[model samples]
Target chain A: MTTQQEFTDYQIDALKELANIGMGRAGAKLSQVFEHRVTLNVPNVAMVDEDKFNSLALKFETGSPIVNIIQQSFIGEIEGRSAFIIGGHNFADLVNILGYEEYDAIDEGHQKEMLMDISNAVNSACLSGLAEQLELDIELTNPSIAAFNTPNSALKDFFFKQKHQETHQTLLFEIKFFIKDINLYCDNIISLKISSLENLRNALERLL
Target chain B: MVNEEQFTEFSKLLQELSSIGFIILDRRMNVIFWNRFMELHSHIKSEEILSRKLTSFFPDVNEAWLNKKIRSTLVLNNQAVTSWEHRPYLLKLPSTQYSIDDVDFMYQNCSYFPVKDSDNSTIAVGIAIYDVTEIAVSQKLLENVTEQALDLQEISTHDHLTGLFNRKFFLDQLVQDASRCRRLNWGLGIAMIDADHFKSINDTYGHQTGDDVLKELAERLQATLRTFDSLCRYGGEEFALILPNTTEQQTRQVCERLRECVDKAPIISAGREIPVTVSIGISFLSRNKSLEEIISEADAALYLAKHNGRNRVEQHQAE
Candidate 1:
């Protein structure tokens, strides 16, 4: 029987390569939209349990008290969720980047729309990148805001609160994006189900 | 070749007949189609706008950002939307004839999607603009009404001259605070403050100057009290202060400080300095006592301060 660590190491390198290709395209799209230089760090792909999902967030420390997270679930060839998190402190900077500062008050619906747009871009680019590489047809839903103005404690339980069908390991892809010109920072996390992991591996092997 | 002209004629009819703003742009961001609604509101004819970049005329439009929205639709085949809240007007169009007052520009909700060809390849991006002026006007009206209601509430509850709680509101708060303190088993402090010789001040100086002195005295008393303390105008140059969770000693000390605050400083009105002083009477709350009993206790102390001499702090004598 192959241990989890062995499987993780074996898949991490390939997944990293796929992530670079995927996030590179996402970054390009973001750069074009923001009219700023957006740089994405090398994505870290690892297999983690549900408990580890909360632990992983501890590695990132933001000065802001509240973390604004945009979450979207995708169900298709694979089932999983994607989240885009930004510090509350940087929300003003984001508004300026989107050229939405002219409005006196931005309504809740409008704020959700703006965040959903960003989520859609990243989720679509990342999911499609993995789908194309594995040659799997995936159906992505319209991006919806799962949580906003989340505290540290609530954000920790975000993953556990999702609808549980069966226990499956998650292939967690973590990437950081920086807009150097505006000093804006955002993190994108994509988690895939472990059962789907086997299907993805088999699909990649057939392509090989 | 024949289908091209037919498509053009169909588009022309759609543009002219539709009330919504419709415009189609190619990959290069060049205008491919501009509907009659756009022409009427923007006052830019199709002849002049054709083949021209939309952002060229509307310099405020974020061309690069808008292109990204178009690209997302083109690449992912998803619809992109912008509301009036996010971006009020993509194109600054004239307001509707029946728009609410103070609304000069049209409010718009815009949608962008990819226009596909026969091969299912996206050739151009289509933008549909909906005039949401009535919804926007109604929202503004609601906000204004809410603000006006809050303003009216403030005017009703506060003394206009001193900006402190009026007699009716002060009495209500006193009754509520006294009952709460009894239930919680905490001491409540009550102090009655009156400006010494205020009638004479108004008689010597004009009423305008008298109003200024009252305002200044209210400011001084507010500064001397803690954040949790409540001060109110108790009618005719007299004020009531309620301090919760305070002992008799603390109440006396607070009243002393308030008396000193008014006595040491002279209020300047109309560029002339006038001497001013106040007498403060302090009382502590007792269980099972009514609000009037507590107030009458403080009122007796205030009377003692006036009798002994003005500009002093006095505690209620034990019966």
Candidate 2:
């Protein structure tokens, strides 16, 4: 029986591998649509305690730091929260590559539709792979997005609360993928309570 | 552990769990089972719909089409799906609630799955109906908005009189092309063209004839240019062309060709053939020059062309 602390490492590695496959597939699909060669990098995985999560996120900052976030809840034998963060620099490059004429005023409704499209593609690719690998049937909720020039204030507060809570464990993974001239950077964090560790271990064990 | 009462309870729970209107039909299209969803969506209750042929109650079910789909699904043992794109059939189910003014409801998606028996023979068909009227209506609204936006953009960027890029879009392109030329180390050229004595033409002939002459000139210019060249209505009785990656000599040659083409064709307007000519000024982008400076140089060349002789091309030589 794997303990909660040990299961964090296993989940990090498993998520990294799953993200690699999913990103590779998404990159291939994007390249076909854009008619350009694409490259995707295997993600860096980390298990961060709540105390270190806030400071750790602050270390990675550049330019305007446009962040696209998607949150989903998975419920089966082992339930957890899944979040994806995409950098704004990558989004600007994508808009240019897709040949959208730069407008003086960006339509909010159009921007929301575009966010939904990108979130749907990336989230579905990554989460479906994770589900298949874990041998679990997971239901996906409608995706919601939050953006900020700086690190998300709510996420920072969430990390602070996690540190105060009895369970101070979270798995964070960062992945960088490129399509032609555009580079896409994503961060995924899977957070779960210690009580769910046994079910998570069983889910991972069935995969092997 | 399998009891008849327990099976009945499980069946009741399964029916209640479904959001879609579920109706089980026999081979003759007689309703066998009508769940609560169907009862709520369609005013017909289980007692009224059961043991009655669908056409006898609804009178809209095309027997030929329904029987064909049922026979196909039974033969293949596969589920048959109907989407709104094909609009297989419209289900007019009455609203159970009397508070709602509209009694009839529109169901967009329907599926028929063949129910088989132990002997592998088709016993019944399960029909699943989904209400997608809201989705269909919303999609149409979105399409309408997109189309209106595209139309408005097109109107804003184009000249209404002569179907060419207006002055605003032309200037925007000039700025972009100038910057691209500077970055790529390529030459960019602009030509300022004006109809010679256009006021005199309108004075001699009517303004209507002068308008015809302008329209005719626009057609000739469009026909004489290459695909890479863009011609815009710079202003009244004047037009501009932006040529990317063109040398100064090539620019002069193109302007001369356009001038000659215009001179040879006499514009026919109001049953009178009127002769017209244009003076063109050409200038090339320089490393030390701004877009405004280059345009001013072309304007000076145009002044020189008008001062000397009309119906000719003049190259801007920095004084």
Candidate 3:
């Protein structure tokens, strides 16, 4: 749990358990928020290096589908960011969910705003669920679109933003949410500050 | 040197007097504080807005979404920023920008900050709104100007009546294509077409009817040509065609199709059907032939077509 030490398997497993329980509540919240049936994926928890992060991103974006990313930082006992990546394929259906009567190209400004609103809801619910389990007081900052109508190449830029954090390694949580009826899906990348995450070593020991 | 209470009063005075919009709301988003600028722009006095929910005055707001943003700011204990690019404005106050257009709503950049009580629990939220309508309007004007400039540039190169490339553009394009064809050892076809008895028709029916007939003939020539063919309004009563990668045989076949179309049907002008036929001159790009020589060859063949019969097609044969 130390800044220099890598995450042990037990910690990763404990975090995965924490994520699944949190996402269960988040999926229900999302279903109500979007008025669509939401399905959650079994969360993937890993400590990633630069090379592993790129390959991991490529695995999620097969055929390099265009995507938009909205990211927000969480503060308090748990510090880091969550980037919710909405795929391009989901846009036509997402327009209806956002209450747009007809999708016009000029409505790009409004479309991005609604997308940010949706992702902000998603990030807050997931992070609060994890923070509550850790007994960590957290505050999520405003969400912003990190990239729009772009390739997943921005995924690298998302990772590098954590360079300012005082941690040698990065803890990443990958969660995929699906609205099957609308054929809409969003992949989430949640990275918590390593130092803040390691602070839970004592609590995780007893909990695990 | 102000005391603590005096300093609080002084800050309160400053907040009310500040130019930017400032509002304070309790947990339910009811207006707790409304500054002078908010009153002036919103037309709602502080006394009127206070204790009222923010959405009551601005009914267009999505209250459900606004509540979600406020709750996140409270739990996260952070200020959330909204840009004009994303939502334009949260509260649609009237714009202050001076313009020829009608009065439009103001574009705003807003922020939401959580206020905590003595016990450290979030008690209220503060919002700050900045007017950015002038910036938004200027950006929109720039986009429109750029589009108009592109349209003007396109108009300069096309014939107004036929919507085809003008004679100047045709001459420039032919020179380039002719040189490229010779360098690549490919053949380029050049054909000149003219409506027979165009002047007599203009004299009898009037210039307007002549225009209608010319436009009709241009449409027929365009339809009979291949996708790669480039048609131009070469003169007052004349049209030209440039066919890429075409040989002598292909050129003759294309000329026949263009000629047959106008010869087959009478051109209908203003619902009046008038019989019409065209004469065409066909020539192909050859080795060691200058562009001027090729053009002159086509012109001479056109004269021959007029001499043979007014409504026939003719090929330019090398001496």
Q: Report lDDT per candidate.
A: 0.78, 0.67, 0.78
* Cα lDDT of model 2 by residue, B23-121, tens digit: 777877788888888777667777887899887877765565466455444533445455543452446765334443443455367767778765878
Q: What share of the true interface contacts does candidate 1 keep?
A: 0.18
* lDDT score for residue B9 of model 3: 97
Q: TM-score of the second chain in each model?
A: 0.52, 0.52, 0.52
Q: Which ten residues in a row have the lowest lDDT in candidate 1 chain B?
A: B72-81
Q: Mind sharing the TM-score for model 2?
A: 0.36
Identify the candidate with maximal TM-score: 3
- Cα error, residue A184 of model 1, in Å, equals 4.0
Order by lDDT, highest first: 3, 1, 2
| Candidate structures ordered by DockQ, highest first | 3, 1, 2
Inter-residue clash pairs, candidate 2? none
Query: lDDT tens digits, residues B1-319, model 1?
Result: 5598898898778679558999999988899989889888899998999999988988877675677677667776656667776568888888975636678899998878779887999889999999998888788789999999988876597887899889878888878887888889889999999999999999999899999999999999999989878899999899999998888888888988998888887999999899999988888888766778889999999999999998999888877
Preferred candidate (lDDT higher): 1 or 2: 1
Where in model 2 is the C-alpha error above 4 Å?
A1-4, A8-42, A59-62, A87-105, A148-155, A158-166, A192-196, B1-319
Residues B114-223, model 3: lDDT tens digits: 77765888888988999888887788789899999988887587898988888888888898888887889889999889899999989988899999998888888888
